[model samples]
Target: MPLAEFDSSVGHSFGLEFDSVLIRQITEVSGLKMEQDVIELKQNTADGKYAIKKLPGRPKAGEVTVTRGLTEDNSFEQWIKDSRFGKMVSARRNGSIIVYDYEGMPIKRYKLINAWPKSLEISTLKAGDTSVLTEKLSITYESVEVD
Candidate 1:
């Protein structure tokens, strides 16, 4: 494949999709439901309102896990650290998409002292869209804990 073709698919444009179960989990945490095709949403409102309200969580070393996406690259990490998703524990583990959590759990309970740091989910869409850290992901944190 030429550099152009590969670039288009990788390190290029973006798309979006939100699974049902994931939406529910977010809704439980955030009180709002996001559709799969949701390409973008705000984290901090235009008027300075936090898009996804913060919630409480226990404090401890968290755990982050994910079924790595094929097209994923270092850009994802850059975006994570740049935007609302602040610096994580360290380097993102290869072959796996880790979601930070607490005390050996997927969602470490913590007050949103700093949004992204406290955010449960940090996602940058295929395009320029982004799913900032919010309460919905925190619900996912709790749900995953239950399962």
Candidate 2:
């Protein structure tokens, strides 16, 4: 058996309730988007779909990209430099990227094992502009776990 919250006054039941009113307002004003990254693959067989064919080659995990606003205190930059500079064998860093809900609760997390930045791109600067600088990082990892 399962339990749920019921609104007797409104004669309705709610399951997995979220702050929809607040989310709608934010979306309308700021165009906020709620999404999660999902990667999938599909394959098809040849020979009139009758002949048994060998399975396709396993797909290697591709790079995972992360982008964030650059602040005065930059930690990611340090990680990149430490991993690649002044070392006999560069050390690999393992970490996770977690996405949280509006209520400040983690909803999804990805574990990046043996990860290193493949590329980093800094935002372009222009005169008379007030946009915060951003950095883009493409990380290569041995594996990824979602939870």
Candidate 3:
């Protein structure tokens, strides 16, 4: 199981628990941050969806997008904004950190928490460039989303 924490000083503490593949995905995804150099500090989780995004910069000209095939836009939005699992992950990012998938009309959106190890104060202070964040964490699923 993957685990992460928040410290609050020098930044927060994140206990990243990724297998092997997941570790790779996160590294690749973290690099996908629509923005350049930003830090995510919140978190949120759903049954099958997970997003950890940095809150910086607006949606550039071209960005990746996600849409629901069978899920209703309102319901899916509600799911991503769920209080328990969507606290810091709310699509609103109202108070906590969040990731917005704004592409196309209606714009399918999800929540983004700060799941990056760069936010940690331990040894992993840099983005996904440190050994502690990359070598230590592992991924369980092959399709696990990194945001």
Candidate 4:
């Protein structure tokens, strides 16, 4: 019998898209996670024995941080501004982070639900500095599903 070969997807080969439109020049992405809160219950048994029970409470989705090089485009900044300007309905969007294999095929996809930019930060500016300027966008979402 021949053993099957396996190849892991690279972290740099991922793409982000929002509202069916692709976002370009993404340099890094982080904070893809979900967790549940724990609830504790105390009860007294018939034999006068005390017991403590732990239960799962509500689920929490993590805030995602996306880093990209600054460009001529200002659309992403506009989206962030919408949230601050009381245009929340227009700011909320659905998005996905897709991880691709070495062959450029999608291997894993995480769907972001009702996502909106929570904060936006730009890289520090200095005179005569040649480093590429970047922007970090922190996004909050209602939930995440594997697709």
The residue-by-residue lDDT of candidate 1 on 35-90, one tens digit each, is 12223444887888778644544443332222223232333344345444434333
Q: Kindly report which residue stretches of model 1 are placed more than 4 angstroms away from their true locations once superposed.
A: 1-58, 72-75, 81-147
Can you give the TM-score per candidate against the true fold?
A: 0.18, 0.58, 0.17, 0.86
RMSD of each: 20.4, 11.3, 22.4, 3.2
lDDT of 2 by residue, 67-87 (tens): 556756445576567666844
Shift in Å, residue 100, candidate 3: 23
Ranking by lDDT: 4, 2, 1, 3
| Local lDDT at 9 for model 1 | 22
Give the range of the ten consecutive residues with the poorest summed lDDT in model 3: 18-27
Cα lDDT of all candidates, in order?
A: 0.28, 0.50, 0.27, 0.86
Q: Identify the leading candidate in terms of TM-score.
A: 4
Order of quality (TM-score): 4, 2, 1, 3
What's model 1's lDDT at 132? Answer: 42
Q: Against the true structure, whose lDDT is highest?
A: 4
TM-score of 2: 0.58
